[model samples]
Target chain A: MSQFAPPVVKIEGITKVFGQGETAVHALRGVSLEIEQGEFVAIMGASGSGKTTLMNILGCLDIPTEGDYWIRNLNVADLDEEQLSVVRSQLIGFVFQSFNLIPRTSAAQNVELPLAYQGVSLSERRKRALAALESVGLGDRGRHEPQELSGGQQQRVAIARALVTNPAMVLADEPTGALDTQSTKEILELLHKINAMGSTVIVITHEEEVARAARRMIRLRDGQVVEDTKWVA
Target chain B: MGGLGLREVWRFAARGITANRMRSSLTVLGVLIGVSSVIVLTAVGNGSALAVKQGIEKLGTNSILVMSSGGAGRFSRSSNSNAKGLTIADAKALNDPATAPDVKMAAPILNASGTCTYGNLSSTPQNITGTWASYFEASNSPIDKGYYWSNDDVVAGRPVVIIGTTVATDLFGTDSPLNEVIRCKGQSVTVVGVMKSKGSTGGFQDADSIVIAPITFVQRSMSGYGSLSQIQVEATNASTTTAAMDEVTTIMSAQHKIKAGANADYRVLNQASILASSTTSSHTLTVLLAAIAAISLLVGGIGITNIMLVSVTERTREIGIRKAIGAPKSAILTQFLIEAMLLSLMGGISGVALGVGISHFTVLGVKPVVSLTSVLLAFIVSALVGLIFGGWPANRAASLRPIEALRYE
Candidate 1:
């Protein structure tokens, strides 16, 4: 545990396999990485190269078959499902590629969903959700249903939801994948602005433009990291 | 989220209910069919039984009847017409002070199935009884058209008779039947009076029927002199009936002079005991009906379980989303549990209402229905059905693995 320089994500020798015996798929093979707090990193890989697998492990939605992972200095790989849920809620925010908003719910309601599990009072949850929407610059549009909102506004509402719980980082899985060119740029700018505000950001995407927006990049092929690049300088 | 209380469960349940209103209505319909059958069948049985019981009670539940044991129904074990029966001697002996002065009254009845004719008004072979005027008092036969005979009419062995209301109305058209002559088996017997419509007494039709004349007159002029039907006795009240029966029995045993322990040559039956037993048998029948309907309830419960399991499958992604956002397994369990209870409670309430409605049709104009208990019972059983049948699927929903659920296609 280190103060003032908390390593937001740490993984060592993570490996994952699917199936058994003669028909095994080695989705991840001894992958290892680390990122300090407030760093914006992008993970780029082709289809079937296990990027989603690693993302799942990093987000605590899954545990590695053979590795240890620490998120914000807490050992997560050893935690059980219930404990992982706690970490998922309080530490990591997620914005899926599909937006994955519950159908027919308004943006503010979606944002407040996470805080409902946190046992926050309704008024407090409303306030925080509104503040998060304002942070993402969609405060006035909180009541619009996901279908009514444009792709960019929808992703931002999802972002506001991810941010409302004050997580250590936001995991955006191709957050701008389905958006138009302008909406993608606007979302990428929002992610940059969010990173500048001191929360770590990790993005998984196949788009070169999306990867190029990150300060650091790690590339994977055939379940192994083939390249790591730092564009910070 | 902090509290799992009834209100929150109800809220969740309301959303589920509104989400699929038609399915809810149909499910409730299944329960309604089940509960309503239980209610209507029970009410019909009870109502018919009440009608029978009221008809019997009019003769007075305290009235003790004796009939030739040639037997009546399945339980008619002791006596039949083939056996020697109670005679006018028995009634005369019972009228003795030593035998049954407590037998406030006793009617030695001799019945013949015979047609009686008056001018053009000819009647079917109805029940023609031979007894003294006190038979009306003991048997609760009231005179609506005319008066019964005096003891002089009975003792002088006059050919006078007190006719039942049915007999008078059929032959004499309800005018004063007294002093009119009715031809029975070619002999003219004077009808001294008309009896009130006794209705039915203990399964015996009192209307379209007959009453009258001394047993001596019946024995001499109608059937053989020694042959008599059974004797009926009226006790002062219910409490003394047993005592009165005891005395009558002791006297009859002496009169018939039986070998030790051969079961009395005569049989005594209590009307109250019969009424009470009918009610008991009816209760048993109701339970059997309910048990049969309970099979439907069981099927309904299973339906609830199966639907919930499908819901778990359909909402796997939602469960994942909730768990991904920090919902505990307990919360998931409660949500599914609430859904199941909502389904069953809705079914029960509707079932109760439908059951009550069915009872109206079954009651067929009768009031003070038999289905109130059935309604309450249906609710409790439906609630239990939820706990029993919904339990496995609710637990299944609650115990889902969030990690895998998130990956579910």
Candidate 2:
């Protein structure tokens, strides 16, 4: 990676408040962070530590109340809801804790969802979806629905979905929270392999073991960054 | 925003609907009932209207009738006190070419009910109308068998009669009644002609259960010859029927010494006016039936809205998944809207089939005539019902925030 390249994500004094007046709850209070390209980072926080809220902001699913947030040098605050959706489709990928695969849909179709939203032709989407499934070691299970697949296999399909668009970064919100220990190990290894291939990966977790798998760790306490540490290979 | 293609939108909607087969089918049945009722009820109304119009047209479009309003006692001159009854003089006046140029022919009539017998087979006709031979042309009664008696037979007061198909069937049982002598009102009358069948009108009056004879003979034997019962007039053409009616009215009013716009003792009725009034009434009935059916369609639309609302609630997480993956609001909206439209459209098509199929058979003694306009209108209205009622639920699904929707259990 070039040293002068711009960071993938940059946020300055980002605040998110719910409700108004005296009853308003401050979900995020003046948080500042930057994430460079090809970096593997883990954001750690306890429940109510605003990690989820921050993940939402970074994924462009939400807007900050009082801050300037940029994605690849583009100001996100100026974009409308439609543009934000486009940014989500083309620029970012999300992995939910519960492996949010659409019910009654095949694994290949689930992986092709983002491309479908981007208006890719049917033949091209099918080809790319099959390739993505193959990359996740489930090429033969392309036609299997989420209900038929195990937790680890479903998580692999989700990771394939997250990488199908070749997004700038992948944001995982407790991706291993709903899996067994063995499934969690497999998912963490998959994330590591994706990072080793020069793709940016961000993992959000409350577990110390999951944090240790990433090269860098940022801890949040009461909506503020309490610790930032980097581990050299 | 670039989003799912139209084909994909429709595919998603189809899948969504098929996911809940029971509820979707029930919703479709609701719309089906509404649309079918609209078609069937309107068909019945139109059928009855057509029956009435045919009845009026059978009396000859250019024919007019003048009848006395002086009550039933006009048959006996001594019982009638103040009101003057119509007489043969009024008929002669309307027949005069100099005074009533539009009148082609006018015949005075005397009506009586009598038991007719031929060789011990007796049948009582609904009415025995006594008039000139010109009555045959004015009333559109063609001869199915023998010939009609002429005006000379009327002047001579000959006992000559023409029987209708019903009376012929009852008396002869398929045999020809021509040149046979029948006893009518204790008088022997020779059967000269048999009129063609005109069928029953609106299932109330039998146009074929009638017998016609010379007016002079009827007055002399059956009625007392006090006053004429009715005068049947024929106009030169259909266009001159109103002029003919006016001329008959003017002559009758002058003969009865009735001033202009005063209460005349006689009433003039023309086929055109009866047809117009009947048509207007039937149109009103058709509209009323259609309006009643529309209410059911509206209820069906509400059923769609109710089901769609439930669907949105059930599929909140699915919508969130799609939205989080970058599905545009329009995609969500189109998906739900297409689902609703598919339901109503299927109902509309099947309803048309059911309604048209039912209309082929007679219902409640009335043959239903399906109007094309009603069918098209019903189908179009059903589609519109889906669009209008589906809008609210679709918007609700579309406007839901991704985070809140995903958070919903």
Candidate 3:
């Protein structure tokens, strides 16, 4: 962690257990990590290695069973569901393997959804959504629905949605998992472009090629972090 | 924009409905059928009640009829030659201002059924009344031609008759019945006047088929002389009909000479009181029919709830996506609730249109009367039903965890 810049995400011995006693499964076991502002990091793990659990924790979709999780100096572990939602809106953006665009809605509307939750004015939302789409190289396709777009284009729309709120961090789970090799490459390059634009980006993936595109990589095994490494790409 | 407004919520709800056209339409159809039935049934109830009121009015809003019921002091010689029931004496007593000050005119009615013949035509008259000349004035039966029996005709027991329009048509056809001679119940009577037509009065009695003659002539010819069945008394106005009824009762009781606590042999039927009581009962019936029809609304509400619950489950992933993108529970709740409201509102509006159209065509013997209060009440209630029935499913959708929902297939 750098001394000058506060970490966008800070974790300290966070643990998550799925159920109580006898049948209980520890999905995240006392894992700790810090990611600074504007860093591009990849989390690598095999199946059942708690990668998704950790990602869910970081995204504030679920509360940890133990320990502290701070985003932008606020203790997320201490926050309620409502406050967590606000924090998630203001600080984190999420992208999934399926793209997750509302099926019948246009690309611009998908991007504008987060702002709608924030209660933005209509014209302003339209402007920001269009700008976000333009930044993701889908400027002309804002009115196109998801089904009308290719897999790569859909992922790009999902990326635009993530960045639309100008969040502190973007969390992606197997974002390129459903894409062809060329689309996968394109998605990774977009993430690089996003990270370079000074927003923190974190990706969860099992593919080595996808992980290598990030400046740092962390691997999980048996619900515990087994390796953490830094690299220049 | 951090949260949804009313317009945005509505738009979102509309989109959700449009997305699943078949399901949404089926839910709306349920509510439509319910609301339309409510409107139509209530209208029918109201219409029938109004018809009954008008019939009573046509019967004469200020008229009261006193009839003997074979109790104490029966005076009619037709019932018992020795025993006394209602008679022409009692009718004259009721007509006297000193005995019944509220009574405008009291006409004694002696009933008979008779076959009347004019030339080759012969038909049974529905009403053969033995009454004085005052009967036409008291009963509001206008004279279309000739005249009623004069005091000379009654005193001499002359067989002169005043025929109603139906009797006139049956016996005289297009020819004038004035001064024509017709045989009634084998008694030859001259038709002195023709009573004007009093159209159908709906289930009470037909007034146009009557043949009225001098009470003396009717009593002597049709039954034992001096026998009478009823006295129809008209009050000065509608407001005093009850007072007029009480006055008639007191005079009759005195004429019968029954003790203070004993029941009188006669009964008085007051038109205003009957109208009021019938109105109350029919109002109750209308409400009952409306309540029964409201059950369909409840069933339709349940249909909306069921469909909404299924929709929430089907769109689990969509909910997850919305939640993950920072939608609060209130937003999700609002979305689903608005969709439910829209479903019922659409159904309600269309149902009202259809109901009004159906009522305008007039069903049954009465014209259906659609009241504005009922239409507005039905509409508002339908919207409330959406909110009420949609509550549980909307809460369920809002309560779903984003992570679990995202993972749902």
Best by DockQ: 3
Q: What is model 2's C-alpha RMSD?
A: 2.8
Top candidate by lDDT: 2
For model 1, the superposed segments whose C-alpha errors exceed 4 Å read A1-6, A72-74, A228-233, B1-21, B68-84, B95-103, B142-145, B150-152, B158-181, B189-208, B363-368, B407-409
**Model 2: residues >4 Å from true position, as ranges?**
A1-6, A17-26, A63-66, A73-75, A196-198, B1-3, B69-84, B97-101, B117-123, B169-180, B247-264
- What does DockQ give for each predicted structure? 0.45, 0.55, 0.65
Question: How well does model 2 score by local distance difference test?
Answer: 0.88
* Model 2 lDDT, residue A69, Cα: 95
- Candidate 3 chain A, run of 10 with poorest lDDT: A1-10
Residue-level error in angstroms, candidate 3, position B288: 3.0
| Candidate 1 positional error at B98, Å | 5.6
Interface RMSD of 1: 2.5
Two-chain complex of model 2, DockQ on C-alpha atoms against the true structure: 0.55
Model 3 misplaced regions, further than 4 Å: A1-6, A19-23, B1-3, B71-83, B119-121, B143-156, B165-179, B192-201
Tens digits of per-residue lDDT for model 2, B287-354 = 99889988998999999999889889999998888888888887788889988888899889998889
What are the per-residue Cα lDDT tens digits for candidate 1 across B286-356? Answer: 66766788788877877777777777787787777777766777677777777877778878887777777
The Cα local distance difference test for each model comes to 0.76, 0.88, 0.87
Which residue pairs in model 1 clash with each other?
B69-B79, B69-B80, B70-B79, B70-B80, B70-B81, B142-B196, B143-B196, B144-B196
